[model samples]
Target: MIDITIEKNLKVYQGKQILKINRQFLSGSITKIYGPSGAGKTTFLKIIAGLISPEKGKIVIDDITWLNTDAGINLSPQKRMPGFVFQDYALFPNMTVLQHLEYATGDKDWINRLLLLGKLDTLTDHKPTHLSGGQQQRLAILRALAIKPKLILMDEPFSALDPEMKAELIGGLKVVFKGLGATVLIVSHNPIELEGLVDGELYIAG
Candidate 1:
């Protein structure tokens, strides 16, 4: 299980306010962080992913203490075993899809399988700049999976795709997650898009 209890101060409307989160997520389950724009959803995910530090509190995953400000124990991103997919679909413009996946996993067979699952086999030699928005998102997801992370953190992963593409990716992701049995945390403002995707919800207030 993932246990998080953290508090941090943030600037809002020219003043500072405290953002507190106390939540738990079961292993191999999908949890959606739902809220409107300006909500602290992304902030909470970043804290859990160790991309940002909380002022006071602890974050434990599977009984492993990832962060405890009071105890001065904080694990870096590399040590967290998390695959983070940014909202912007961060990818190398010069690298082909195959190169990106190969660099992440160093396994050609696995990369090929991922390409097939994502329906991106024909685009392996294409660069991010040449691919469509949905294709780019798929590549980003494949790269993340190539690392074989225990936890997956996605921020607005499908925001750029069309409805049909979104549905296809969602279906593919469900299969991948089921096979890997990894913990997934997704942040999105659109709850409609999250239907049939997450097992539970975490609503964050800005």
Candidate 2:
């Protein structure tokens, strides 16, 4: 399980207040972080993924300690074993879908499977600019899965896709996660979109 207890300053409309979060995330289960906008959802995920630091906190995943301000220990993002999918679907402009997958890991077989699963097989050689919004999002997800990370953090991953496309992508993700047995944490404002996607929920507030 991933255990986290952290407090950071967040800018609210009135002023700045300390955002306190303490939770335990179980492995092999899809967890959804549900809240309204500006509720510190993205901040919490970023902290866990080691992309942002908390003012005071301790984060431990599995049995590994990722951060402990009191102990003067903080691991870098690369050492955190997290596969993160940004909200904007951050794909390299110049790289092809295949190149993105290959850059995550040198496993060509897994790349091929992910390509087939994400319906990106035909767009392997196409760059990010050549694909549609949904296709680019799928490519980003495929790149994250290629790493076979211990935890997957997604920030509004399907917001850009239509309902039908979202359903199809979620189906593909289910198969991939089942095969890898990886834990997933997603941040989204739409709870309905998470109907069959997550096993539990983590509600956050500003």
| Each prediction's whole-model lDDT (CA) | 0.86, 0.88
| Segments in model 2 whose C-alpha atoms lie over 4 Å from true places | none
- What 10-residue stretch in candidate 2 is worst by lDDT? 188-197
* lDDT measured at residue 56 in model 1 versus the true structure, 0 to 100: 96
Candidate 1 per-residue C-alpha lDDT over 1-206 given as tens digits, one digit per residue, 9 for 90 to 100 = 98989997876777787789998889999998887676677778788889888899899998999999988999998899688888788898889999989888877888888998778999989999999888898888888888878889998888878889788889988988888889999988776997998999988776
In candidate 1, how many clashes are counted?
0
Q: Which candidate is the best by lDDT?
A: 2
- Which lDDT tens digits does candidate 2 get at residues 1-206? 88889999998898897789988888889999987788898888899888999999999888989999999999999998688988888799879999999888998888899999788999889999999998888887888888998899999888888999888889888988888889899888886997987999988877
Question: Cα lDDT for residue 82, model 1?
Answer: 85
Off by over 4 Å in 1: none
**Model 2 TM-score, all chains together:** 0.96
